[model samples]
Target: MKTTRKILLSAGSVLVLLLTFYLVWANTGLGSETKQSLKIDATASYGDSSNKGNVVGIQAFVEPVDYASEANFRRKIRFYMEEAKKKNWLIPNKSIVVFPEYFGTWLVALQEKERIYSTPEIEEGMQTMVLRNAGRFLATFLKCPQDVQDKLKYSVFAMKAEVIARVYQDTFASLAKEYKVTIVGGSVLLPDPVVENGLLKTRGGLLYNTSVVFETDGTINPQLIKKAFPTADELGFICPVKPEAIPVFNTGAGKMGVLICADAWFSEAYQTLKSKSADFVITPSYSNGYGYWQQPWSGYSGSKTPEKAKADVGKISLGEAWVKYAMATRAKEEAGIKKGINVFLQGKLWNLGADGSTIVLSDSAHATPFVGKSALINLWL
Candidate 1:
């Protein structure tokens, strides 16, 4: 009888622990830490335009947040941006706002409510879901015909596709509308990104790291350009696919082109934009480690350095290397871009230590150029 009691007690304890974990997993909130986001730093050089046509790089600091719904992400952004106007931050007619790459990419995790936010570690949270959905994950990514795993994966992402895309679009579109500025919505991982009739939609197969542009009216502009080159870590999760043809956006602010994350590392991209006579470039990037910005240049990101630039990554700091090769060497000199902005997200998401501070490279002399670590950088068009 005593032995029987011991067995039951052990079973009960296990059940209790599982139940406790479940409760904690499914409902982790941002907690009591409600404070206005720190400005961190701000710099402006060679852009003292008071009248109009300003491009702003928002180096936002995101928290370990799990959204109950997609709108919550927008709410958070709105709250953080309240500090902008009071500081006399420049927002004028025909302005452009650039966010960081993959800033909206994590919204897909919200599909699994459990531990989406409550998991103490981002890797743990993503892994937990990945374990449960292993078969489907493989199936969708693999895209094998008549394969149960592939079909299941496709169905899952397809069902959640609209939500993931919507959360991304709404978050940035809303901001653009509120500020009355054309906004680059950053990059999101979607199975298929199709912008039809000014609404974003997705189809399931393999994911692509895609960035979209939104006009001031909170509607998406129909320019679907995929990342031409992806970082090593992004390989398994997404595939690199370029658009059928390069398309430059003719926004009122300026003739703008976007290079999402590592896409900016290629000269071909710059050449394509230059062919279209792109007036300004917005490069949205996310460096995985916090100190990578200060690390020595480890050769080209993916492409060969231009022979004309004669760049030696080994001899230069990573930042200088970026100014040289990443944006296609002497961006102002080669691309004919007198003004540009590079924005990076500054937050700890999952395992990614967001680094690579924002920079606004300009050929303007009288206007001070952004050189150091500044969370926000603005340029006049």
Candidate 2:
């Protein structure tokens, strides 16, 4: 009896050990599989020549609003993410880039507001005596450091940059965490604060117009160009950065090229991407409706009439610029078509072939409303 009991105990112990080993091995293998399947290598290239495989691009138009509201912004983003998740064409393993309109305005605004409220104006306003302070009210309420007040005046600009950064971070982080997709070429406005020279004591000095790039790893990439395009030594507009100047970074799954709205209008920018052997160019833009100049207006006689209009409305195309740029890029792949300098918006997605042939995978010309809501274009290569 004693020998039989010992034998049974030993066999039970060995069985328990085997079961533990199997569980550990299975869990470890499961982790490895998840990492391999879920993580995308965005830095992979399609070679130096014209793209050989399928390429996909998405243009998302974030609506324009006079003021920045975080709740509204978040809702809009959540809707887009849900839509992307639902789309059948969006591949879980493939790369995706989203172009958001006017991203810089929101970022700059948020920063400026934070700076302004940090001043002493809040305390001064609270301490005011209503009856006795009538004369001093304006002075006390308006009292701010001359330099500080000047800075506050442009707080709107600063808030724009801050909101943009927050939105990009939140949107990209959520989508990456939840959907496992990557966003490329997210936009931010860089402020150039005007600095007063110590000796000169002037009000305005340093101002900045910069577009920021966001990577998939929840970090912002360096500025593509310090000053994308400096204007009048005080303003910077969207301009093409040299391909060689762009620093190469892992985009998580596949290599991506970043471009702002105006940058897309320039051929040199596309050439730059081609030189870098980029697989896709992600473009973000803020475009107003096309026929602004031809919009109907009230006449001096107070009559609502088409005769009062300066130009024919139907003849003007608001989205012509985008169309032109798209066509030029497509034409580059055509055998006999000469390259044209004009920018076209040939709708959303175009697949460029090495044999100089092109296919329009998706076009949103008729589908997207002209009211500035966001739109998406997805294509498979």
Candidate 3:
């Protein structure tokens, strides 16, 4: 009996030690060993390349992101810029290149374990991220009582807010300086983002989907554009900011007004731009799910669909709704805007299916939409 008890105790001790080791290993930051490379296979272009437009819209159809390291992400993004350089689409100081929405939001997964990248579902990856940083995440989660609907998402953004800002700002700023062109660095979900001394910083508050614009000299614009309309999916986590005035940035390319995706559907958005006398408008947008563009229109995503847009809700497809109601339709008619750039992000992220045709409008008429990966849609201003 004594020998048996000793044997059982030894086994239990060994088991406990094994569990401890496994927990430490699972939480430890194990960098990804997989070398990622972006292939430009489904390359397509719209508009006349010979026209040499001062404004270029990069239909950055990216693949499933691998946030193993910051450098990997930069390497992948650089491919798009390099491709533009080779085609002479980018002209230093004379060109403004716009990217699609949610371009930097994925930075939340930066420097995660290999498992995070290999997970088939994005939720699983985020779970791993939370598990790895449970203590910090829980602290953040408790701090955000105001965001009862999306406290989990709020916690994720809040816990890693600083790092997300750093990677996102630094990446775009460096790229703009390196390419010597004005870059609208898509959008990132940050808590009350503000520009101070030419750097993007976040104050602890409700998260907002914000877009940052970098000048040719790499200085961030003082005015940070926040999304006025949060989509149905975003409503739980994102807060719409009522700006005192929507800004029209004066750039070498032109007076540019940027309206985030869903905001383009509202007449008030265009009116704001019109009041500013914007020369051109760029709508950085994202459409989730596979083949959603072809799906039947579900009407305006956030808030109430303006009475004018209600009739077309069920009758038209989502793609058609964009052309008829979004920047393509509103830029010229309401804003008297000469050109409009509506760019969509393409690329499958786990179960998050991606679909949208990048549309470029000149004189309010949209060109043949480019539907494929790694495409460049340009309109000569």
Report the Cα RMSD per candidate.
5.9, 22.3, 3.8
Using all chains and alpha carbons, the TM-scores for the candidates as numbered come to 0.78, 0.48, 0.90
**Per-residue CA lDDT of candidate 2, range 154-187, in tens?**
3333323333545555655555445445554344
- Report the poorest 10 consecutive residues by lDDT, candidate 2: 30-39
> How many residue-pair clashes does candidate 1 contain?
7
Name the weakest run of 10 consecutive residues (lDDT summed) in model 1.
Answer: 365-374
Best by lDDT: 3
Clashes of 2: 47
Tens digits of lDDT, candidate 1, 125-146 = 6566665555556655456334
Q: Model 3, residue 285: what's the lDDT?
A: 90
Give the C-alpha miss distance for residue 58 in model 2, angstroms: 5.9
Between prediction 1 and prediction 2, the one with superior lDDT is: 1
lDDT of 3: 0.80
Better of 1 and 3 by TM-score: 3
Candidate 2 Cα lDDT to native: 0.36
lDDT by residue (tens digit), candidate 3, 1-381: 999999999999999998888678666766576767566544434444443346767777654444567887788778888887887878888778888898888778777677877777989988888987777899888888575488888888778888989988888889999999899988898988899987889888889888889999888999989998889899988888763255789988779999989888888888899888889888899888888787789888767787888898888888888999888988888888867788888776667867788776774465345465657765667
